[model samples]
Target: METARSQQQTAPGAFLAFARFALCGGGVGIASSFAITALAAWMPWSLANAAITVVSTLLATELHARFTFGAGGRATRSQHAQSAGSAAAAYAVTCLAMLLLHQLVATPGAVLEQIVYLSASALAGVARFAVLRLVVFARNHAQTQKPQNPQQPPRRHAVAGAAQGGLISRSESVEVTLAS
Candidate 1:
């Protein structure tokens, strides 16, 4: 059963998680903005955006899995793929925002373009945070954070579980054990 303290922890925990997500993902987005611009000097804008998006998504997902979501380890391939979907959405939003900016103000100033792009990126980041926390890393975080049943005998696993079990299961196992 859930205790009062555990319940309280949920709200703050989520807030902290979002904070971390913003830090890691936002940092990557900011850097990628510059990267995409630099690459555009050598290639088409769309290709630059595509390349930067792919790289940033990979980097951000790993940071999120390890530090932001408290997944306790590296990200899985499945998580990376799900994260890419959200990243694609973000890329679309940024592209559309820039496109609209150009439509309204032909030959927009660089500052104006940056503002519009970053604003759109911020909006998409919020949605991406939800998707990442609740979807991409949900199972990983849940598996890491399960409370132990003190009354029951300790759980064992055939995979690479934690070296010791106390009141909880800290196993990093990806394998599911069936009860006989």
Candidate 2:
């Protein structure tokens, strides 16, 4: 039942979903890059980048959980928890990959190193979108098939003893006048 047309109409199925994640990720990346660069100025570059990755991943997970997938009512505390877990794993992977790439290429210059780190982080962002969209915020498609009950008002009953009163007792059977 998921046609291309339907998919196009849905926010998740649209490319904007990825773009939305990317935009939020970009803000996280900027904060990360600034932190990394500042730390690198005083300490080892690798350590700085690693620290930034850890911190930024946490921030990005919460932002994405609140903003990106929230349109479909998929933003829940459990989803944020899952995103945080995934971001932690992804952070480690991203840091290791960037560090390895930098060591292998022998690029110690700040600018070049940052460029490489950003590229690696960009790849990690793609992985994040995949995991978050497919696993974390994924809605159950099967639940939509069940029949739904229409809204109805509750029934009122008249009590024998309360015939003069406005209220009726629950223990007694009462005549309920039908309203036109």
Candidate 3:
């Protein structure tokens, strides 16, 4: 029999999960792009993008968990902390990848930098979804119980009427019946 979890691990669910992540990230990306573009007028593009990504990631995580994943309740501190840590790690990866792309494809007076950054960030969002689904979201700490180990055995005890001397003289054998 297939369990719910097993079913959810299938390709359809994986696609759905990726779609959800993309939608969430798309919403965040739009906001972040706007902010970064505005800020880039006065600051370096990388710095502006970095700041916007952080803010956008926080917003995206919250909205994604609630709307996409059907998460309930006000996020607990631990949950927020976990998401924040995940977002930071994901953001760092995204920024680094974007920077690499910028260095590779960039030229003076070219407007392709932002496009490259967006693509790289989208790829990073895909990576982030994979990690979050497999690592963070899959682990339901509250519901799952750890399996018991099977290798440990109980201590042996002497059977009743077992003689330590092991002497077998003529003796009457009695048959005992057990009732179920």
lDDT (0-100) at residue 99 of candidate 1?
78
Tens digits of lDDT, candidate 3, 1-180: 222233333323566767777787787886776787789889987788678866886677676566544443244455566766766776676568666766776553334656765776777777777766665555432222122233433222332353334532224232221111
Task: Compute the lDDT of residue 85 as modeled in candidate 3.
Answer: 71
- Of 1 and 2, which scores higher on lDDT? 1
CA deviation > 4 Å runs, candidate 2: 1-11, 43-47, 71-75, 105-107, 139-180
Best by TM-score: 1
Candidate 2's displacement at residue 166, Å, is 36
Where's the lowest-lDDT run of ten residues in candidate 2? 141-150
Q: What lDDT tens digits, residue by residue, belong to model 2 across residues 1-180?
A: 232223234545538778889899988886787788889889886677667766776677667756675434435667667777766766676578766877688756777767776777788778878888888765432222221322433244535556456454556554332332
Residue 122 Cα positional deviation in candidate 2, in Å, after optimal superposition: 0.8
**lDDT value, candidate 2, whole model:** 0.64
Q: What is the lDDT, from 0 to 100, of the residue 26 in candidate 2?
A: 85
Off by over 4 Å in 1: 1-12, 143-180
